[model samples]
Target: MTGSTRILVTGHNGYIGSVMVPLLQCAGYEVVGLDTGYFRGCTLGASTTSVPAISKDLRAIEPSDLAGIEAVIHLAALSNDPIGNLNPNWTREINAEGTVRLAEMAKAAGVRRFLFSSSCIMYGMSEASVVDETAPLAPQTEYARSKVVAEEALRAMADDRFSPVYCRNGTVYGFSPRMRFDTVLNNFMGSAFTTGRVEVHSDGTPWRPVVHVEDVARYFRLMLEAPRGDVHNEAFNMGVDSLNLQVREIAEIAAEAVPGAQLVLMPQPGADQRTYRADFTKFSRTFPNFEFRWTARKGAQDLYQALCSIALRHEDFTDKRFTRLRWLNHLLETRALDDNLHWQIEQQNVA
Candidate 1:
């Protein structure tokens, strides 16, 4: 393998990671995985590939774990608002502090490229027609706040050797070994497939930039391949302007994908109205040749087919393993993980 071939992808067992690890392997990179295996059981289909992984918590990631890794694609986190709302401190400790600690360890171990998986959700409820990398962060939820904090912390660590690139992704959709129905597009698609109804909880005017899991992996590869001068300490909003769509648009697409699936619009008080249209000019300019293969309609159709192929039932759609919040809540309620989100003694022994 080449010097830059040995890459460590944290959250390699999670949604994007499950898809990404195999893609990286096919591209001739020696990929090592780092995940706590919290959702290893959450499989929509058999995984395409596997890697030698460190079954360790992000908070406990030691310097030795970074020994042979050349680059780091950090993706492990509490994941979303509901989970973060479950315990804000858990998000703060794991997502924010753990990210800094891992980056610090990577820097000390001479890992050159640190690709931090960030979210466009941090541009919280912006009035700007199009929020870009230069837009002021107004993180509303603990989950979004953690990303902002992680990026800020990583920025301070960037230097001549340690180059950290933040890829602020739009809401990711499509099939993964570790599938999720928590994200907007995926949730709508799942509902359409399983229940024959795609429900829009809001007025459907909320704008969300949704990207495919494969595209996310592709961009991560591009980030790794880009020159040091081009990407060093840079932040790029992932996804194109064409991807930005209203909640109703996404639901309609999902409904269309699954024939006979009804679309229900129920705009209510205090519904999730978080909206933002991300400007992807920087990402477009940086990687002029890179193409995003999956559009919302295509992805929804693909997801519908995937769901149908699996014979996915309502029970499976509601399974705790596939939903991050429900899974985490199950772990917490069962005492598999303590209040701090650390594994209990019994689980620790197995890990």
Candidate 2:
């Protein structure tokens, strides 16, 4: 293995990391995972590692934790929309403030490169023909705001010694070993397998961009190998054409993947917080050798197939009690553990 391949991934216990760790290993990276795997059913990699990163706070991380780290992929954060909304202050602290601190620390620790996994949701509402990297941002939520801060911080920190790559990705789908049924694509599969229909909570007419988890994770590995000048300080929106789908359209596409599935438009009591389409043209052009691949259909189909293989049922999706909003409310109302502690107590207490 190339000695320079030593890699450290924060959130290695996250939905993305569970799959990403193995993918990195397969690509010849000597992987190290740093995480607090508290998401219910969360796993810290496809397999355990001797160089395990304990469930520790990023702010309190010891200098020793930086051992052998050459490059870092910062994936740890409070990612769910509802979770972000629950305690905006807490979410910002970790997702935004903590990220800045970690990036500064990583760069200071002699790491040559850093990759940040930012969401495409940063472009809240499209104002232009389409959102290229230069498009003005319309961040709709606290989480998106936090990411925006982190993205800016990354740009500010870009210099000769440290190369930072920001991947502003679309909504991710596909089965994860540390599987989360919370994401839109996963929720669609979970709801359909249980209730025989996918519910569209919004008007279903908004334009949204979607990308498979495999492709998102794959792009990280690709960026790792790309020439520094070509990859550093640049943000790439990962995916092919951004599809303008009404929630109904996505439901229909998802329904086709699983037999007898249907789309039910759940009337919204209020305005929805998320709705936007991205312009991935700049990213495509940036990595001309890098390809825009994977369709939401292929992702939905792959997810549905994976869901069926597992023994799950309707009760799984209907339990809105576990929804991000519900959990956030529980934390706020009950004051259990604290406003900032985990929202869900998992099957193993780690997702």
Candidate 3:
């Protein structure tokens, strides 16, 4: 966890990873990136920091990829529910199987700390008001199921030599080089900023724990540096209790952040009602001094300002590059990627 510690961040070209790599580098950690280049050209305004990266698929990770790596921050996956629904097998293959494969390789290579980038979405439709780490995982979608399966597999792999810590992050928001308008808050912010309207398809009763991208990176760094005894083989719900907001509340915050944005709730039957309010008591207790800097309002304002600076248009907001499912579908339809989600043609260099 010192300045000399070399970290391997998978999916370094994605939303969170794009933000995370630069932060880690600025904090003095030697960072290496590994990504398949699915969202390679997906930059919002400015480009992310470039690092020495292995341009390889997650499922195709080789042992040499882990060579000289001290810790592994596993973020590569199908990434979202719609993409998971697109093909369950790909989610299982890459997120679940690929994670274990990479962990096994990291363990063999004498990598001490393995930080799994997990999600609280695995606590699907919990009856409990505030679910914690001990909450039963009821993954409704293939995406959530992949995280659950991968966490279980990683837990089993944790031993004296290999320490696996699961950072169960919430719905992450805020700006990144590889920006995503697919997540709830980010989606709402993008719509509010670009279209001057925040649209809610559901009744807006579903609850989601939202976290800022910067705070997520900082917390992961904390986990990486903390004593192994504290975080080893454990799962921490990565957000504060105050960050848990209902869909309507999030939309309101987003709408309020934009100058002329209106809030429209067109509740339809059978909308995505998956809701869970994560209890971050454990995270607070573990990282006592650590603070979540961004609130829903503040994050919304930040996104609004960033969008304003870039002069983001409705076309850019609806661009496939910023949305994972649409972009992957485009890749498949265009035959850039095969049916197996593997790149058929050579990938272009990430800008």
Candidate 4:
């Protein structure tokens, strides 16, 4: 690939996509954003920076859709545990199958680099342990399992024209133009503002590795430019070692960022079970000298400022529009799938 080669970013309007488009453009790379604009046409546009954009979904992607694209950065998906939990079948269809489809299309179009925005949550909240890339993956959610499947499928390609890189992102925190209110740190910060207390439904024992969204996007940019042979068929865990925090500690950071915000821990939710601290040495080994810049405190502070800037009230949280249950309800109401919306699978099928 030549300098300033064209790159196609799927989900280019998402939380990380919005930030990455500019970073790539500023670094002298031509960017083409491919998105269906699911988040209200909010995905980032090259028009905003030096890159141009194409509005298209993954399944309908044509050869022309990827014309002149040297790399494909795949980030499109339902994008949350609650969203995945909404309809596992829908999640599987979109996240797992859709990713493989994009990879096949990219390879067909002569694209050489493929970066998948994966989740470290695939490790499953392990009890009494730390996880590395080799850690026995015990994913507990449909979303995590889908990601694992996507990883295995794409990496199976192992072709010269098609290289797959997995960025196992930690508990992502921080601000984006397309800010997500559902994330742990962002949600906590949103709750902290003008609230009685930041409630940790969990007793705050589960360990979570954290990273700033912008930094995670930076990783994508780096992988996009990396040689096909360097990171191909490899998965890199993304996050700062210092940022592996408990829910309560994250709450503490949030409280500090938002003055007078109190953090209160409660009984743990049954659905929240992953608790392993991750060793990012694998990524460190892969990249060799690359360093992460954002810490949880800096990220939490940034998210707090963004949340406080919004004029929201306590009623918003309870409102169906902003709550998980209602969001899932609305998704199901779309009748996108005919299967049971609830987690109805037998334990055998789920694994």
Considering every candidate listed, which one attains the maximal TM-score?
3
Give the clashing pairs for model 1.
Answer: none
Compare the candidates by lDDT and give the number of the best one: 3
Weakest 10 consecutive residues of candidate 1 by summed lDDT:
342-351
Against the reference, the lDDT scores of all candidates come to: 0.90, 0.73, 0.93, 0.73
The deviation in Å at residue 340 for candidate 3 is 0.8
Tens-digit per-residue lDDT, 1-351, candidate 2: 133488889988767887788778877788888875544343212343334455676656776777668899899988867777677987788888888888888888888889999987898867665677777888888999989999998899989999988898877767776666666767777788887888888777666677778887888888888789888798887776744455567777888888888878876867563566676776667677765456778778877777676656666555544344554354446543354564333324322
Q: Tens-digit lDDT track for model 3 on 136-161?
A: 99999999999999999999999999
Local accuracy of candidate 1 as per-residue lDDT tens digits, 1-351: 233389999999899999998888888888899998888777876654668989999988889999988999999987898888988999999899999999999999999999999999999999998999999999999999999999999999999999999999999999987899999899998888889999898899989999999999988998988889999999999988899999899999999999999999999999998999999998888888999999999988888888888888999898878889888878888888887787885654331
Residue 338, candidate 3: Cα error in Å is: 0.7
Clashes of each: 0, 10, 0, 6
Error of 3 at 286 (Å): 0.8
Residue 130 displacement (Å), model 1 = 0.9
Candidate 1 runs further than 4 Å off: 1-4, 345-351
Over 4 Å off in model 4, which ranges?
1-3, 41-51, 268-271, 308-351
Candidate 1, RMSD to the unseen true structure: 1.8
Each candidate structure's TM-score, on Cα atoms with residue i matched to residue i, is 0.97, 0.88, 0.98, 0.86
